[model samples]
Target: MAATAEKVKRGRKFAQVLEGARQVFLRDGYEGANVDEIAREAGVSKATLYNYFPDKRLLFLEVAKAECQRQADEAVEFDDGSAPPDRVLFAAGRRIADFVVSDFGQGVFRICVAESDRFPEIGQEFYRSGPGLVRRRLADYLREAVARGDLEIDDIDLAADQFAELCKADIQTRRVFRLPGCRSGETLDRIVRGAVEMFMARYGVKKGQTKA
Candidate 1:
């Protein structure tokens, strides 16, 4: 139908605008990026760009959400609750830590921090799309582990937040501050291992123990 074709065309244009906006935001930072450049880069008219995104903040929010979704989809893969808690948590932690410390992630984070005072909604959007989403997913996993008696969590949500914070440990601060050293895999592994150990120590149950 003509309506369906129009919708498909609009979807493609929307994707194109997002792709261009992402590059602009990454290259120029939120404060420096301009709608004109974004429209030009996306090969769409300024009117079209505005039609899709009313303002740069919304566009940036979309970009941030897309990036978070992509990372979550690619990194956080579990095997139907079959894997051991340590294995699953470690895998998720490592991926999250790595992504948080990556250049792209750092760039996006900096933009949110820098613009938060001027545009508080940007920070809220980033939180909802990024760390908030991750925390919820982790809590779901923890709840499942508790049901299976793999963990003895009193508050799965709190435990999930704590575990995620633990994974950051020394790494996130350094990355945020633009410290000199690189985040090697070994260092990330060590951090995740330590976090998992602490989490398990606190919440892990013995073979026959019930929720005590």
Candidate 2:
């Protein structure tokens, strides 16, 4: 969320390598991604790729960090106006759900879990940049919604967490394990909409349609 986490040697091919890494990492995941594929995707030689990123793990970490930053930057803050709570929450839920099911998002979580024993800070940093940031911003939005009489919640933070969890219902775990046919577009739409409906039932002052 701050500066790029990894300190790889940078050169003309730095961005090129990263772009290739991003594609391969997102396509095949960290363990499945081969260095040669990344190099080929980036149109660089193996020696050039190694020169920029000595360790494949570091390269993956850098990609994960960039992803988190990208999500943070793209996250919407609905504090400036009176966007309907239902619409706002649905948008947030959709964004979260989409990322959670995405290959990049899966990679970020997997790397954090796999490296937790060796590098605890990696997990912590991911939390700060990813889930933690989402919770904070969502809580802020919920607090404002309550003030606007759009929602009824005793605990904004808890509500934020609940909504986030609701978005992942029956989606994250299945997708994480690569279960077949778990990522149908229609199925994801149902899950995200269901999450918003449940949250609104609990907190919405007046239930409203969240369908797009």
Candidate 3:
């Protein structure tokens, strides 16, 4: 139908706008990015840009959501319970830690923190779309693991939160502050392995053991 075609076109245009907005935001930060530049970069007219996003804050929120969703889609994949708990946790933890320290991730986080006071909503949206989303997904995985007798978690949600925090450990803070010394793969792997070991120490169940 004509309406369906129009909707498809609009969705494509929206995706284009989001990609352009991401680039602008990453380069200029939220306070410095300009709508005109975003519109130009997206190859859309100013009117079209405005029509898609009513205000800069909403546009930025959408961009953050898209970025977070993309990361989740690519990195967080333990839903089907296909892999062993150790392997799943390590993969998920490493992915999260790497993303939190990546340039794009750091930029988005800095923008949220810098704009938090004036634009608290931006911070809230970022948390909801990023870390919060990841935590919830991890909690679901933990719950499933518990049901399978692989983990003996009494509080899956809290365990998920703890595991996430442990994975980040010192790396996230150092990266956020732009501290010296690059994190090599070995260092990251070591951190993730330690986190998994610590988690297993508390929640992991040996074979033939019942859930705690």
Candidate 4:
């Protein structure tokens, strides 16, 4: 009973500290935020914060992880009804494009890029939370399409990676550098549509094209 209670207490304590750290990181950014301030905001002693996170770098990494996870969760709900596989790809690409160009996505990108070099593990964590999972999800969908005869690809995993790259276009660079008036929405639509069509032409079974 005592051990169980202790575990629950520690879990709650970690949650509280994580929430506080996110607010501090968002307000002051990774470079400006301090451990003591985070601890104070979390209603824990500096020692307590250390007991949970060990260092500010790890704490910030966790914050990025949480943000990416939230975005990935949102990707779960994209129902564009039954359509041509490539057309569906275009729609999914545009949805992700809008999200990446949004204010919240830009903020997450900034935080991750600013802190990624300082703590390389944080980069891995962020990738796992976002792009890594996205790639895996795409691969799974492609494999399913293959089974259903909707698409044809020799290597599902590689195809999935290429598909995601098709979606990304130059959006990341535009967002990171804050390029003046980057194309989004319908403009993004044209770019992603072209890219998806090109990708499908290369990998997917074209209409009337013989399967290799």
Tens digit of lDDT per residue, candidate 1, span 1-212?
Answer: 11222222245599999899988988788889999999999999999988777767677767776776665565455546889888998888987888778887787788877877876765676676677878888888888888887788888889989998999998999988878664988888889899999988888886666654
Q: Model 1, poorest ten-residue lDDT window? A: 1-10
> Per-residue CA lDDT of candidate 2, range 63-135, in tens?
7777767867876555444678778877888888888888768877776776678657667877877788989
Weakest 10 consecutive residues of candidate 3 by summed lDDT: 1-10
Candidate 3 deviant stretches above 4 angstroms: 1-17, 35-58, 68-72, 207-212
Q: In candidate 2, which residue ranges exceed 4 Å CA deviation?
A: 1-7, 25-34, 206-212
Residue 202, model 4, lDDT: 81
Each model's lDDT comes to 0.80, 0.80, 0.80, 0.72
TM-score of every candidate relative to the true structure: 0.77, 0.81, 0.77, 0.70
Clashing residue pairs, backbone N/CA/C < 3 A, model 2? none
Clashing pairs in 1: none
In model 4, the clashing pairs are none
Question: Candidate 4: where is the Cα deviation over 4 Å?
Answer: 1-28, 34-62, 76-82, 209-212
Better of 3 and 4 by lDDT: 3
Q: Which ten-residue region of model 2 has the weakest summed lDDT? A: 203-212
